[model samples]
Target: MERYKDIDSDSGVLGYEINNDNITVWFHGSARPYTYSYASAGSIHVEEMKKLAHLGNGLNAYINNNVKFKYVRS
Candidate 1:
């Protein structure tokens, strides 16, 4: 069983379930779903998931990184 911290730390994802053939990642407060198939122990599929997680984190970082507020003088 996986810990909730692992899932909570991952943005847009609520949790994950590992099965024999694949892993299902729960997202959007468990409203959306994504499935991923597993390959060999050391395979591209695993790497792909890692990349996706990184990309997701990067996107969140980019969105939250900077902001500007402006007001026009009357």
Candidate 2:
């Protein structure tokens, strides 16, 4: 996994990793990570997530507002 870029968020999303088909997110105080995919969130949402992850902003809000329950916890 790649290193997670730190971001400012009140949602406890510490960082994220974007892959070809999935995204793994690290929460501030959680031991487990959460993963989301195009299947669950759709292609458009996945693309937007990738953009937000690269920009190092709005990922938390995007997930919260868009795909909060669409992830698989690991």
The best candidate by lDDT is 2
lDDT of each: 0.40, 0.78
> What tens digits encode model 1's per-residue C-alpha lDDT throughout 22-52?
4455555554544555433223453444454
lDDT (C-alpha) at residue 66 in model 2: 97
lDDT of 2 at 48: 92
Write model 2 residue lDDT over 36-70, tens digit each, in one string. Answer: 88887777888898888787778888988999899
Query: Where's the lowest-lDDT run of ten residues in candidate 1?
Result: 65-74
- How well does each candidate superpose onto the true structure, as a TM-score? 0.39, 0.79
